[model samples]
Target: MRRAFPWLVLFLLCLGLTPVVFAQSQSELDELRREIAELDEKIDAAEAEKSAVAGDLAVAQEEFYEAAEAVDAAQVKVDAVQAEIDTEEVQLAEIELDLDTFKTALAATEKELTETETRVVDQTAELYMATATQAPLVFEFTDTEEIALSSAYVDDALGNSAELAASLEGLRDQADRERVSLAGAREEQQTLLAALDEKRGRLQTEVDALDEVKQVEAAEMGELQALVDGINANIAAAERHKDGLEADSARIEDELARRAARQREEEQQNDGGGGDGGGAPPPGANGWVRPVPGGVSSGFGYRTHPISGARKLHTGLDMSAGCGEPIYAANGGTVVTASWYGGYGNAIIIDHGGGVATLYAHQTSFAVGSGTSVSAGQVVGYVGTTGYSTGCHLHFEVRLSGTPVDPSPYIP
Candidate 1:
């Protein structure tokens, strides 16, 4: 009988463990939750890094694109400058050729004028010397001829005649005029050469300036391209770094989740409280408090996210209700928070005792704020779809410590 009594006691002890195993203690759950929260922080940091990288990438791409455009524009300018230089060079060459041709023509004309002037000078000298030497003889012959009175002497009477003198003077005058004309033409040609040279020099200077501009533009383009390349590299590096952070965060989160799951499993195994959770309800209470009375618009599971258009599992249930519907306190507790939450605009949180908590999200307005105390069924807020939802609804969640659980069991 003593042995049977011990067996009964052990049996009772094992039975008592069912509820204990069903709910983890606040301290142990909080520790595990703290680890999860730390991992969540890591994930958040990783996401922030990733977002920064994305921004860097966008800026880099924009700069790269602008730089590429500038490079192309500079290249076009370089091409244009090259063409202009070529054209100017050709024009300079043509000008030079023209100057040379004109110079050669002037030289030829000068040569002809010099030869003609020399010929005229020689003719005049011969005529002057002949007349001088013959003048004295003529004077002597004229006296003899007058004494002899010959018929041929009459023709010789007109020695050093006006016609010969006049012709000599006229020839000299023509040579002088030819010399003046040739000299003047040579001076004109020289003036033209000087003008052409000046023009050519200016053109050359312009070409040089264009060349310099091209070099500067090309260099600037190269530098900008390098900057763009560096920025792109930085963006890539930042992206990789951000990805690493995200992966690290994910690993930590996975490890935390795995540890938590293992702990939960171990607790379940030690107390033989696996999936079976049916038990006697808490006594002295009419029933479980309804968190918020509303029709279920969406249940827990996969659903299309309204904003992201992504297929994601709904972590909790969505309650269908009108906008500004008076939201009630799920259970008697203090308000943990009532504020806007990301993707859950105008949210409220209620903390029940023993680490039990409830979240009401997508509220049009709030009736309470953080630190406010309230009883069950007290109006806490108004309900509406404010973020990441298709219609007016309340996103409700039940958690033990920081871990989510099915709300249906506690609701009824």
Candidate 2:
């Protein structure tokens, strides 16, 4: 229902009713007022529904802003967690490179140790065979020549052999120590790498969760923004309707003023003595009667608006009448307006001579049409809760040359 307001506003604005001429009769004037009133009704409806939606739109916009902020915060956390993961990965890569280097060194140390052991085994075997051969010669030799020859061979063979055996033993021990140290270093690197991998995994999990949260918040923000846009469009439609209604009302009022002026001029020319035309009930005069048989519910003056809660002139006296109750004319006059009249729903306006007029508003239906001359206490309409009224009642006003005055002075 709310979405259709914009199209309705456009259609009404395009109507472009013909302009009113000065010589148009009271019936033509009433038709114009009715048309304007119908337009006003549409405008008022659009305005009436806007208040609730506008409030909703405000709340939605606020939520959207909060959601957007939450998304941004979540993104920040995700980025931080990802950064930590990246740092851990880099450390892990370094540890892997160090492990590879340590393995290479261990392979070379083991190969050198194996070669040294092989050389030591070969030297030990040569020494044992020489000792065995020389032992037999020692037992057989009683001559000094044999003894000397055996001794010379032993010394020559024994030269630096013991020292070489000692040096090989030291080399083997050094290789064993290096292997232990390398193994420990590799183990330490592996342990550190495992810890970093675990930390990175945790950070990655955190980042994934934060990303999901951010996506949800962003989606919510998008929905709220769409709602706000829709509400703004509704408000725009209402504003357009209001503008059209004002334009039409101004035209009607100007026409009424013109007609009133013309009537007064003609009356003055005919009287020639500048008589009062037997019009305009003086102060404390008994020229007008009550329009409705009810007590006053509200008196005319400045008061708080019931619907809008703004300070404005009440503009009329509210008579406590029930729905369908007959509304009488305040005095005898021609009906200048008997149609929907802006905030005064289903209104009737009677024009008495001497610039005095009376209005009755918020009627369910009209008893008489425009240009109809009605006598005092004549039923012009039935009470209704139309226009700006809260219930079935008659809004009575007395105007002097189109400006509303206190109806009390004219009603007695």
Candidate 3:
């Protein structure tokens, strides 16, 4: 009877262990199911992010095309105005040559008139001398041969004097008319020169304006190109992230399935086992806080560049702050980049897991290093006016799957 009692005690102990083992298996199964559900949610979020990035890329491409076209049109206008200026310059040169010719002709005409006046003065003096030296002779003497000869001599002298005076007078009138005509030609030349000058001025002004327009257009095109490049980079990064997420989800699913199978087998093997277990904590929250405490000096969207005056996309928020002001991390993440970046100055980029990231730009100094872990509100850098910044401020950005999105919603 004592040996039978010992067997019964061992049997009761085995029965007590069975439910504990089965309860442990059930707990494992529930954990796997929760993990699978989280993976499914992550996949859905990744898909939506990809779609958004694609749309932004398309908009950026269209803007680039439009900017290029504007640059082309401005260049054409500049060329046309320049051409008009060149034509006007040529015409001005020809007109100047014609004016020189007119001036030379006028000088010759004045010289001729002066010479004619001098000749007339000399001839009049000679006629006066002849008349003073020769006495008035009356042809009353009865000598017919002498009378006829004297009469013929006097008549010929009178006829010669009258012809000389009349020719001089006609020469004077012709000189006066030539002078008037030359004056009119000079006046016309002056008018033409003034008109040509005005035309040149107008054309030059147009050319200058067009040149300015072209410069602005060119600047806008360059900005657009940069924007397109950024969008392309974002798209590439997003695609890679999507692929990674998908792979991760697949791996997680496989792991969950394996764990579920193991749990089921364990439960079947220990149908009499019983236990209680706890589940893991839920996934981390998805959101961000402001990197700096200040009002936004510049908002995200298209705006005219203050320095370049070109319309361009402002991809991030510019928080106004004093130089050397501390900049905080927006969320918990691993710093992927911490160094000088083109146009961004001393920039820092953090990967916050689940395809989320944040950027801090134009910093005077860095407080964090690459590959270092950081927590929300941790100082990562200082505000500065480095690189292309117009003032001391923090350029904060939030990226979902590497695509820049408006950071306003994420900020508290």
TM-score of 2: 0.50
Q: Which ten residues in a row have the lowest lDDT in candidate 1?
A: 1-10
Compose the digit string of candidate 2's lDDT tens values, residues 1-412.
1232354345445344454343333334344445544555544554554555455555555655665566566667556656765766676567667657756765776676677666666655676567768677565766886778656655655463666556667766776776676667657666765765676566657556655655665565465445446545654654555455445544544555465456646866887734322332232257576777688988999999775567999888998877766677788899999986757866899998899999888766666789998877776776766566666778999999989898887776
| Candidate 3: Cα lDDT at 316 | 88
lDDT tens string, model 3, 1-412? Answer: 0011223233223223211111223233233222333333333443454455445545555655665566566556556656765676666567666657756765776676677667666666666456546744533446996567556655655566676556657766776676676667656666665665676566556556655655655565555445445444544544454344334433443454365456645964787542211111122245455687789989999999764466998888989888756678887889999876756756999999899888998776676689988877776766765545666789988888978889888887
Best by TM-score: 2
Of candidates 3 and 2, the better by lDDT: 2
Q: Give the better candidate number (1 or 3) by lDDT.
A: 3
Each model's C-alpha lDDT? 0.57, 0.65, 0.61
Residue-wise C-alpha lDDT for candidate 1, range 1-412, written one tens digit per residue: 0011122232223222111111223233323323333333334444454455455545545655665565566556556656655665665566566657656765665566566556655655666556557656544666766455333332343342445445546655665676566556556655655665565566556556555655554554464445445435444444444444334433443444455457646866898863222222232264455655666777877888755556987777887677545667767788988875756656888898899888998665566679998776676775655444455668898889888776766665
Which candidate leads the pack in lDDT? Answer: 2
Name the lDDT value of residue 295 in candidate 2.
Answer: 89
Ranking by lDDT: 2, 3, 1
TM-scores, in order shown? 0.35, 0.50, 0.38
